[model samples]
Target chain A: MALKLYLDRMSQPSRAILTFCKVNGIEFEEVKIELAKLQNYSPEYAEVNPMKQVPAIVHGEFKLFESHAILIYLASAFSGVADHWYPADLQKRAKIHSVLDWHHSNLRRGSATYIFNTTIALAFGQPLNLEAAAEGEKILIASLAKIESFWLQDDGPFLLGNSQPSIADLSMACEVMQLEVVDTKDRDRILGPRKRILKWVEDTKNATAPYFEEIHSIIYPAKEKLQKLKTMAAKKEPQSTGEPA
Target chain B: MALKLYLDRMSQPSRAILTFCKVNGIEFEEVKIELAKLQNYSPEYAEVNPMKQVPAIVHGEFKLFESHAILIYLASAFSGVADHWYPADLQKRAKIHSVLDWHHSNLRRGSATYIFNTTIALAFGQPLNLEAAAEGEKILIASLAKIESFWLQDDGPFLLGNSQPSIADLSMACEVMQLEVVDTKDRDRILGPRKRILKWVEDTKNATAPYFEEIHSIIYPAKEKLQKLKTMAAKKEPQSTGEPA
Candidate 1:
């Protein structure tokens, strides 16, 4: 039986896993769990992932959640994939693991918070929580600084000094790419200062090539919708109920 | 040269790594980073880990941070250790990785927040943030429920159903054990509703044996101190400065 992957394109981890499968030529069924429609909360999907999160895979009867785990599993189970994506060398592999683990609490958390406070809140027509956005920016800045000075400090382009990109690179680059949904000013202020991080993100995108672009195609429409919503909000008259729509 | 491990026994991940090394008989020089003393912020220690977090290891010349990564590294780099702690079988290892990756934002985050709001705040003679503690309790409750219903639903004693416990078990057990510092009322309200989780924690402690108890011995004093501080605050007259101290 072929592997099964449940994902929503809008999610960073989902894109990371989808790109991995596409780049590696791993055949799998992509089951879309649309976040906007709250499809993940459905009973059937929850069975596959009780956490109701995207980027879960079912390989035969073995089901796995957590994108990094799925990535590592795919790399280990499949034969003939490029070894650099998740190296077999003990030290190199461990370093990749280190970055992936550190990511959950740092980069991923910061990026998700920043996007939620700025972009998602606007999309939903909710008032921006400036305090929360400020906090998220703080975390995002600190996380980016750590990535530049620590993870990307090595001479090579990829994390852990690899000539080829690894799963850690894919996971983190996808996370930073999420900032695309925010307005130009907020996005620039948060991500603009980091030159090395920008280059590394570009390098990772190049390494993944067409699949990266293909999987991330949905971001355009999403960004467009957010822009339209912002413009509409600015021109709207004050309503009796104080609601935008 | 012996491997160097930078850890503060008070931290959960640090305890997890320390116990792993002790159980496996991996010779390591324990470099204590006294978190309370702000030693982790020192210029010297920041070079070891720019994040300034405990549970970093220097194996030979290679430096690694993040306890999960260090655990995986130690499991792979060393020989003669029990395989079940970090199984080499592809499916089994992937499942362990899945649990470890899911753990960070869910279990560890909630548990740390609960401990900090209730116990650590008291220890510092700071007024408890009731709102944050309530929020942390909600997360902790949901997390514990997930552990029982999803992860512990397996028929076997351990997380992945092996007779022996895996590193996931150690990391999670340590996280839950942190609630020991909270007063009984708050702790019971948060943890007492869960039966299976308690049993699983006890089973994990038994499986890890003397090493788990030995490493966690410091918690007793800390818990006692927090209790005494709470009692002292309750009995004292209102302070002139409008603070507990």
Candidate 2:
């Protein structure tokens, strides 16, 4: 039986897994669990994943949740895929695991908050919380700063200096790219200082190319909607009295 | 040169790694990083792990951080350790990874918050934030409830039906055990209803035995201190009015 993958493209990890499968030519049936509709709560889906989060998989009799875990499992189960994605060299792989594990508490935290509070809210027509957005911006910036100072400072472009992107690169770059949906000014202010990180993001997208674009295409509609909301909101605001103020 | 591990017993992940090392008979030099003393910020330690977190390791020229990553590295690098701890069986290992990754955002969040706000604050003579403690307790209780309903429903004693404890068992048990330092009522309220989870906790401790106790010994003093504070506070409170006013 072909592997069964449960995903929702709105999630960063979900997109990462979809892109990974496409890039590696892994055969799987995609089951979309739309978060917007809360379809993940359905009983049938709960049996497959009690956690009801996306990027879960069923391979033969095996079941797995957590996108990174799924990624590791896929790399191990399939032959003929590039080893750099999850290297066999113990130290190199350990380095990748380090980034993957660290990601949940760091980059993932900031990116999700920044996107949800800013872009997702706008797309849904929910009032934006400026206070929360500012806090999220701080976290996002600090996280980016850490990546620039530590992970990206290694020789060459990718994390751990590999010429090709690893699962860590795919996972983290997807996380950082969520900043694209944030208001342009807010996004630039948060991501602008990290020069190496910006370059790495472009490098990863270019390397992953068609698959990355294909998986990420789902977000474009939401992004455009958010942009339109911003334009509308800006027009509704009172004009500033430049001289008096 | 021996593998060097930097850790502090007060941190749950640090204790998990320490216990894993002891159980697996992995030879290493323990370098204590006293978090309470702010030693992790020192330049010397920062060179070892730029993230400045405990439970980092250096083997020969290779360096790794993040406790889960370190756990996976140690399991692979050391030969003859029990397979069930980090099983070579793909399905079994994937289940373990699922728990480990899920832990950081869920169980770890609640337990860490509960400890820091209630016990750690009392130990440091800082005022306890009742509001935050309540929120933490809610998260902790919800996380425990999920574990009981899903993960612990297996027929066997351990997670995923393994007779032996895996790294996930060690990591999660250590996290949940942080409730020991919380105020008696708060701890009871959070952990009391989960009978199966309590038994499993005992089972994991017994399976891992001396190492679990030995690694967790550091928390005893803090636990005792918190107990005294609770008792003293109880005595200082005004006697309840005999008649309903």
Candidate 3:
């Protein structure tokens, strides 16, 4: 049976996994679980991943969630995946693991929190949380700075300074891509100061080519729809203010 | 050179790594990084782990951090480590990785955040964040329920239902140990209903024996000290109440 990848491209991790599959030419069937429609909570989807998160996989009888794990599994199990994605050398692999693990509490947390507070929350009929957004921004910037000074300190374009991109590069780059859905000003403010991060993200996208751009193209339209909603909400606010108290 | 393990037993991940080393009889030199003293922020510690987190390892000049990554590295690189701790079978290893990765954003986040807000925050001279603690508690319970129903669904004693403990079992059990430092009432309320979680933790502790208790012995004294401080603070409250406004 072909591997089943349950995903929604709107999710950062989902996009990373999708791009990885495309880049490696891994044969799989895509099962879409739309987060916006709350399909992730459906009973059928729950069987594939009780966690109800995207980027889960079912290879025959084996079921796996958590994108990092899925990525590692794909890299290790599939003979086609290049070694640089998850090197065989114990030391090199360990360093990549370090980056992947550090990502969870730091980069992934910051990006997801900030994007949800600023944009996605509105789609869910929730008000934007400025305080939480500010906190998320703080961590996000610090994470970017670390990527610049530490992870990218060497000469190579990719994270950990490898000539070729690894799962860490793809995962972190896709996370940074989430900033695109937020206000342009906010996104620029976060990315503008960090030259190395900006370049590395572009490098990662390039390394993973047309598929990377193709998968990520969903974010632009989503951003436009969100902006239109915000504008409509702003226009309605004045009418509410004029109503009799 | 012996593997250099930089850790602070007070940190759950640190203790996890420390216990793993002891259980496998992996030779190592323990270097303490006292979090309470803010030694993690020192330049010297940064040289060991640029991220400045505990449970980092320097094995023959190849430095690695993130406890999960370190545990994975130790298991793979050391011939002395047992196979069941990290099976060579592709599917088995993938499932273990899933548990380890799922742990970061769920169990570890919930346990760490709750403990920090309720107990550790006071030690850092910060008042209790009741709001954050409540939020953390909700996630912690949900995470525990998932662990009970999903990961421990099978007949085995440890997580993922393997008879022998794996790195996932140790890492998660250590994380749950953080709840030990919180108030007894709070800890019991959170854990009392979850019979599987309680038993599994004990099973993991027993599986990883003498060293598990030796390393984790620190938490009891730490818990006692926190309780004493709470009692003193409560006693002083009435005196403040009697003072003139």
TM-score on alpha carbons, each prediction: 0.92, 0.90, 0.95
Rank ordering of all candidates by DockQ, starting from the highest: 1, 3, 2
Q: How are the candidates ranked when ordered by TM-score, highest leading? A: 3, 1, 2
By TM-score, who's the top model here?
3
DockQ of each: 0.81, 0.67, 0.80
DockQ of 2: 0.67
Which should have the higher TM-score, number 1 or number 3? 3
Residue lDDT tens for model 2, B1-245: 47999998888899899899898889999999988778999999989998888989989888889999999889999997889889988778888989899988888877886677665765555555655565566777788988888887577998766778899998999887777777677778778888988988899889988888877777778788777876665577532222223
Can you write out model 2's per-residue Cα lDDT over A1-245, one digit (the tens) per residue?
A: 57988998888898888888889999999999887777889999898898888878888777889999989888888987799899998888889989998888888877776677766765555556655565566777778888888888567799877788999999998888777777678778777877899899889988988888777777667777778987786688632321123
lDDT of 3 by residue, B1-245 (tens): 57999999999999999999899989999998888788999999999988887989999978899999999999999987889999999999999999999999899888887888777876766566666776688889889999999999577998888999999999999998888999999999999999999999999888888888888999999999988876776676422211124
Comparison by TM-score, 1 against 2, better one = 1
Tens-place lDDT digits, model 3, residues A123-223: 76666676677667788888888888898957688888899999999999999998899889988888888877888888888888899999999999999
Q: Provide all candidates' interface root-mean-square deviations.
A: 0.8, 0.8, 0.7
Off by over 4 Å in 2: A121-131, A227-245, B122-127, B226-245
Measured with C-alpha atoms, the lDDT of residue B170 in candidate 3 is 91
lDDT of 1 by residue, A128-216 (tens): 55555665677888899889887886779988767899999989999998898889887787778888889998888888898987888
